[model samples]
Target: MKPLSSTLAPGNGGAAGQTGLETNNAGRDMKIIATGLLVLMAIVYFTSKSYEEVHPALGFVRAFAEAAMVGGLADWFAVTALFRHPMGIPIPHTAIIPRNKDRIGNTLANFLKSNFLITRIVAQRMHGVDLAGGVGRFLKSPSGGEGRLKMGASRLIGDIIASLDQDRLGSMFKGAVKSQARDLDLATPLGQILEVVMKENRHGPLIDSTIKWAYRTLDANEYVIRAIVFDRANTVMRWTGLDDRLANEVVDGLYKLLADMASDPEHPVRTKSEEALAQLAVELKTDPALRERIEQWKLEMIENPAIADWIDGIWENGRNALLKASRDPDAAMAGHFGDALMQLGSSLQKDPILNRQLNRFARRAVAGVVASYGDNIVKLVSETIHGWDAQTITDRVENAVGRDLQYIRVNGTLVGGLVGVSLHTLGYWI
Candidate 1:
């Protein structure tokens, strides 16, 4: 930004033209007016000859009028000199504002610092503003609120997600879980976050939804299920070559048993299976050898084809969600995320203690950023100044505000004449 002084500079070509025109007009007008005034004063002095010869009052009037003429002439000359040579005489200290335009700019800068740059005044003006409240108010609006949330969250999440190294993540997880034997003791911080998910019942839905979906879509394909039934029944049929009725009876019994197992969770057979699993879970938790076996089983299970297929499905679901989220802003699932962010912002704003903490963090962050970038600001100034030619600076200023300055010359001439008349009158009065 250009300084105020630079902004007030005279205009170029057109401004120069206008200035020239005004200077000429003022000069012509001043000369005509001064000469006319001089003639009038002379007439006054000569016409009162009787008073001048005998009367002190007439003499005094004559002196006064003569002095007034001299004052007016001197003032007119002085004022005219500001724009051009007075009486066509080239003298120093004339037309100062024009001849010393660059100097005037430098002095104007000094004047600004001396007159306006006081820290107390600046601080007072700034303190009068409730900047924090205004910012809060702005961020409270729906659109504005969303915009602010997106800006910060997107910056953070983008950086994090983009820089994610799966290997590093896996290693970090492994390292984190490495201290425990078989099972890790959950940290309080982790537990607290987990508690919220539990309290909110968010985790229940995920497990319930998955199980429900799997059950609802159970593969009841006749060939696949019947194949298992017939394959087992065939062993008996092949061994005995049983009658058709016996074969049919055996297959029916086999299906009934499978159905019974599937339907009855608390059946004796199911109880035994459940107990064995529970016992294993306990053994894995308490026994080192059992824990290693369990870990091996877990790793093997993860490497299974079915697990890969499940994982592939999960990856597809996640990718699809992200794709839809990024493309379709109106997608409820994605929009909910934006809404959640807005809610977070609102919560932060309402929570005074949290707000103060955030503000402190923000201030420190801002101060660090400012400190780091402080040189850039100075560098920018230095580079800008270095890049700019002096003539360009002068021209830019002149273009912006040069025309109005010609009025100064006009004011000078008129004001000078008034001062001259006053001084001349005072001279006579004495």
Candidate 2:
């Protein structure tokens, strides 16, 4: 049975087959016409010779007919010899295409490799191609490359999502996160962050808030302060009535001092708080003992089983969410992927620098490949031609150019007749 493509093709004979058939038919038709003219000339020559005694004009007719037959026969031989020996007689230089098919093939291959497939020619042609512009137009078109890309990406994502082992991914993710955390030294970065905060005076607000909380606590617990003051008084003074009054006076004085400290921004206590923070920041950064302690604490946390469990839990939760989303057709992940592809296409179109780089790379890649494989291509062409039989080569060449060659036979017969007539007239006039 014939292939579907062959069956569905426009004509039973394809382009090359159709062209070969047409040429063969035309060549046969011209051969018949040329042969018929030759036969007609022969008949006329014989008839003129037979009638030459009856009329003097018959001599010129005989000359023209004889010359025309000679010309037609000569042209027919010349044309036939191109494909085969004329009349089956063995002749040199006959059937030239079949005789030198291998050499012809080699020459043709070399010519193509040198002229058409050279690195410079390939590069120049590649550079001239508007690859970026074509891509841009395809992506920009609604039903063109953009839609195809989206469909392809969707299928790929679906396949990948379906193929993933959730358990394996979860384990890998957990292991990777824990490994990274354990490998990282947290102390240096933390200290640097603290140093930056202190330098920018960001810790000032924190100190103020701490001070306000302390003041609130102290004010609310005045009775406790009073009892402590009374206990600290002399035993004899406590026994007298003046002890209570003296304790009140001391408590009031302490309250006044607290108020003054809190109200004044430049108070000694505020200055001391700022100084303490600065000192702490410096120690965290510069003090090796502090830094080592912080590192040790971080390592302890990382090494804890609880911390490992926590990391695993995070991975499990994330995996579950991802798997669920992947199963959903309307998931944002697929949409986001599509958007990203479109954006990339747009960038390739709009960004001249990127487009130029892409085109330059493409040209270089094509040129490099052509340079590397050109010899192989030439060899392939030569080998293909060499593989064909002599008969096949003869048929192919004759079919391709035979129709045009038939015209020479027709011209020769007519021209020879005219020349013969002119010569006969000149001879008679002389």
Candidate 3:
């Protein structure tokens, strides 16, 4: 038998390359050993046949050698037929792998789709996997040293954003914001917020601030008030100096009234202000006319060019900020992202209910993806294998199992020799 050459091409390196080279060498070596045994058997068979008349022992030796050669030749032919036709002849049932490569690819793809990629099986397998915990740990610590995973993720985000059309993205964002804003019930929420503020008496500080502002304004313009009072006075009052006293009285009275409102929480003006605010809040909540007006106002605001421009500005600023954060090495966005991930992970770890829910969600998500795209994935696998040339298919298959097949030849030769010797002994006795 001719020794089969190595299937692996030259200059192949790395673990995969080394593995292929090793297997190829092993198969080649075994093929040589098996062929050498066959040659030795052939030499013995011819020599023993020539000397068979000289000695009875030669008869048994000739029988064993003859049988061994036959067995080795049969096994070698069988093994070679798997990858290629024996002696390069286009024999029937030969080169089985190459002939059925496409079929094999389809069979493999269908088997994977039916058994492995099924939604139930995938979900079951994922059910036990703590994907969230794994993600959390990865986010919390630098994976494979020096935070490369985090940096890689940040760069990926940056690349995705960079690849996007900023103007289009901004437009979409603005549209979405307007859409949501249009759907919002502004009056009810405002009313609820106002109710909460009043319940907590948070408006007290605001009222006090308003009072103080008014007092300051009146004090600053006292001279103006006095001049106005003097101008409005009659001629007799001005000549008698009564106008000056009246102006001072008017200014003092105004200051006292403001002071009273500030010092007394239950003052008439304060009470009236609270009542007015309370009434407005109630009207916002329960008055249909008021609510309708608010809704109309909201619609108008949403439709306004100024609001559209604001939304555009917001989207631009946000998109630019995100892009900058993603690109900047010194930016804390990545660190913040990592920290948020870590916090979420820690929470998932600590909270059993949350962990279980998240795991269920993850499983469902994965199962959904599999259900949706499993056929496409299977088709991809089949098409990829089918695309390969017959020679490529033959080489890969032979490289994988050729060594084991060569062992069969060696075993066949020895087993055939023993059977031949036993048969010779039985025939002689008979």
Compare the candidates by TM-score and give the number of the best one: 3
Per-residue lDDT tens digits of candidate 1, residues 304-401?
Answer: 77865665565556545644443333342235676675566566667777666666555555555545664565445445545555555544443443
Deviation (Å) of 196 in candidate 1 = 3.5
Question: Per-residue alpha-carbon lDDT of model 3 for 1-430, expressed as tens digits?
Answer: 1111221233244345778789999999998999999999999999999989988789999999999998999998998898899999999999999999999999999999999999999988997899777765554553436465566556667777777788788878888998999899999989988888888899899899998998999988999988998889999999999999999998899889889988998999899999888888899999999999999999999999998888888987888888786666345425767577667767877788887888889999999999999999999999988999999888888878988989999999988898898899899889
Least accurate 10 contiguous residues by lDDT in model 1: 181-190
Q: Sorted on lDDT, highest at the top, how do the candidates line up? A: 3, 2, 1
Per-residue alpha-carbon lDDT of candidate 2 for residues 317-388, written as tens digits (9 for 90 to 100): 766665555344334334666566567678888999988888888888888878899899999999989999
**Which residue pairs of candidate 3 clash?**
none
Pick by lDDT: 1 or 2, better one: 2
Model 3, total clashes: 0
TM-scores of the models, in the given order? 0.34, 0.46, 0.60
Scored by lDDT, model 3 comes in at 0.85
Q: What are the lDDT scores of the predictions, listed in order? A: 0.52, 0.77, 0.85
